[model samples]
Every structure is written in C-alpha cells, then in structure tokens.
Target: MSDRTPNPPSSQSRRLYQMTRGALIILPLSIAVVPWGILAGSLAVEAGLFDFQAQAVSALVFAGSVQLVGMGLIKAGATLSTLLLTTLFLTSRHLLYSATMRTRISHLPLHQRLLLGFLLTDELFAVSSHQTRKEFDFWYAFGAGFSFYLVWQLASLSGIVLGQSIPDLDQYGLDFAVAATFIAIVLPSVKKLSVLVTVIIALLLSVLFSVQGIEGGIILSSLIAMTIGYAISIVRKEPL
Candidate 1:
C-alpha cells in the first residue's frame, strides 16, 4: 500500500463544507438574537400595532434595533419624517458592512447580492466578516445569514404570540441579550490598539448619550468611533 497525501477536496465539496460550517458556526450568535427578536415583536405589539403589523415589520424591516427604535418612536407619536430619519440613521451601519464585503461579493449575481443585502444584520455581519478573513465563501455567508433570518422570524412570531398574554415583557430586561451578544462578537476582534480604542470610545459615548437622553446616540457613537479608528490607521501607515 502506498502512503500518499489525500487529493484536495473538489470545488463542490468545498462549497458544501463552507456552507455547513457557516451555518453551524453561527448557531451561538443566532441563539443570542432570539431574545432581541422577541423583544422587538413584543415592543411593536405593545406600541399599539396590530399582530399582523408587528409580524410585517419583522418580516420587512428584518432589523432588530431599527424595528425596536421605530416602534418606540411610533409609541411616542413621532412625525413621519422623524421616523424615517431615525430609521435611516440606525441602519446606516449596514452600508459600512456592505462596503466591507464588496470586494469579496462583487462577482456574485445581482439577485444573490440583493438577497445577501436583505439578510445582512449586525450579527450576520460579525460572523460572516470573521469567516471571510479566513477564507471567502459566498455559500457559507449565505447559509449563515439565511439561518439567522429564519431563527429571527420564528423568535419574533413567538413574541407576537406572547405579547398579548404577557404584559410589559420589555421590562424584564431580556433586551440585555443584545448588548451581551454584541460584546461577545466585538471583544474577539479587538486585536489592535486602534480597535481597542474604538471600542472603548464607543462604549463611553453610548453610556454618556444614554444618560443625557440623546436619541440615536448609539449609532452616532459608532460612526464617530469608526471615523477615529480610520484616522488612526491612516496615521500609522504614513511615514514620519
């Protein structure tokens, strides 16, 4: 018997492996979003939206933070323009996410890219971006993103079912899962000094903005931190 190295996996097998790995690797983060999804649905119901309306928001918006904040603005009787602007501000981060993956995904067909854009979320961006750094795989990214979307839909449905029966579900602090999940995703990627500084600044600004009762503070802080981080990188790259 000859002892020989095994042949490399076929392209088809490699795609299947990455897709399966993507789905499985994203399970923990997908689970982490369950509570956030539930909260979004419950909050929508609590804000005087019909059950179908809540479900529609979850289905169409597909963004937990935007849905939650939009519901709050609705409850507060915000103007239509205010609602639209707030939503745009909250979801603008997705533009950055898309830009980060543009080089990798540019070759995909328009329909597939649209599907990916629709499925993209904070958690999916975190997981898929991490995976992309190791090896680029469209099937893997699609699998991870689609799985998370399914879990989110089911979780939101459960919330809608319970929203009427359980009063003040939001007061239970289940929303903490959102922050915890983001922390888990972020801490692992803060390898450089610039990244660490960005994280710290974002955290501090978030808390300060919250205490000051500023709307959209979280997104504002994120934008500021990212800008500063980019500047730091540029400066580091320049010759003294």
Candidate 2:
C-alpha cells in the first residue's frame, strides 16, 4: 500500500454538497409550479381581489389549486361558507400527505416542523420523499423547500404586478403550460402495471368530466382511480 494519507471531506464541503444536491433535486421540478403561481396571481387580480386579499391568498393560503378555486368562487359572488366548504374539499388530500410524513420529520423542532408543513407542496413532497439520503437533513430540506417557495411567491407577485398591464392574459392560453407540466410530471412515473392502469383510468375519467364540464370531477376521478389501484394491489397480494 502507498504511504499517502487519505483525508475525509471537510464539514463545510459535506454541508455544501448536501445543500447543493437538495436544491438541485427540487429546482427543476419547481418549474412546473411557476405557471400555476403566475396564473393564480393574475387571475386573483382580474377577479377583483384587492391587493391585500390576493396577498393573503398567495402567501398565507399557499395551496395553489385550492386558492384558484376559492378565488373563482369569490369572483362569482359565492358566499363565504360556500368558499370555505369548497376550499376544504379541494385540499383534503393535504391531511393525508402530512400524516404520511409525520414520522419522518418528528425529530425536527416545532418551528421547523411548522415551516415544513407550510412548504409541503405536492412537488416538494415528491422530491423530498425520493431523497432517501436527505431524510434527516433539515437544512437540505429547507434549502430545497425555501428555494421553491421563493420562486413561487416571486412568480405570483410578479404576475399580480403585471396583471394590470396585460388585461388579456387569457388570450395567451397560459393554463396549457400548467397542464403540460403536470402531464410531464406524471408520465415519468408510469412504470408499474398497476400505476399504468390507474393513470389510464384517471385520464379517461378526467376527459369525460372535462367534456361534460363537471366541476370537481377531476378530483373525484383521482379518488376513484386510487381506490381501484388499491383494490388491484389487494387482489395481487402486493403491498402498495
């Protein structure tokens, strides 16, 4: 053997490596969320939401789909109770997501845990979940989540600022970008036969519902498809 001493990595180098890896993992995925944020901000303004209300919706509310639906209901003159019920319905899935991650993050301080809850978007959760190595790295999760949070908030704010200038944003069909982004996210995960079947069923249901203009049908289809997938797994005696 050679007489050279092999030094382990420095603490600074390891921390930097983790942070960089975590941020890189989520940054690309966050591009999918940018259009939704812009659309939410611009639509809020066009829907006659006051500046402060829009801020509350984007900053405090933080759930993109829920906020969009809530803003639309508000614009349509829906009652406060109606908006509350609808938003709750739209975001009910978050309860399940939070519960799933509870054990993993239980060691974090209370404040950091609260922050994680706030930043736990679908994309963030997906990325962080796949990061098996960083499960216990609070700073790594923070780096990924905080970077995504900044992009979303800044994009929404920018859209709000530019909404007044571009009164005809709908004419550009920006919603298509958000739809395409979701498709891109889903397509990569269509590997297993069960997952493939579930996706096909969900797509068919979504198309039918969209053609019928059935409000909330997409969400309903998701629930139904997931249940079907679970039943399939049981029939195969496979764990989900």
lDDT of 1 by residue, 1-240 (tens): 132236655666766877788788778777777877888888889989999999999899999888988999999999999999988888888888888888777778998888888988877787777555436667888888888888888988888988855345466565566567667778998877778889988989989999999977867898899888778878777322
Off by over 4 Å in 2: 1-16, 47-53, 130-137, 166-192
Q: What TM-score would candidate 1 get against the native?
A: 0.77
Q: In candidate 2, what residue range of length 10 has the lowest lDDT sum?
A: 1-10
- Cα error, candidate 2, residue 98 (Å): 2.2
Q: Runs in model 1 with CA error above 4 Å?
A: 1-13, 47-49, 75-77, 131-134, 166-191, 238-240
Clashes of 1: 0
lDDT of 2 by residue, 98-186 (tens): 77677777778999898888988776676565434334576677777778888778778877887855334466565565466457667
Model 2 sits at a Cα RMSD from the real structure of 5.0
lDDT of 2 at 61: 83
What is candidate 1's CA lDDT for residue 30?
76
lDDT of each: 0.81, 0.74
Candidate 2 matches the true fold with a TM-score of 0.74
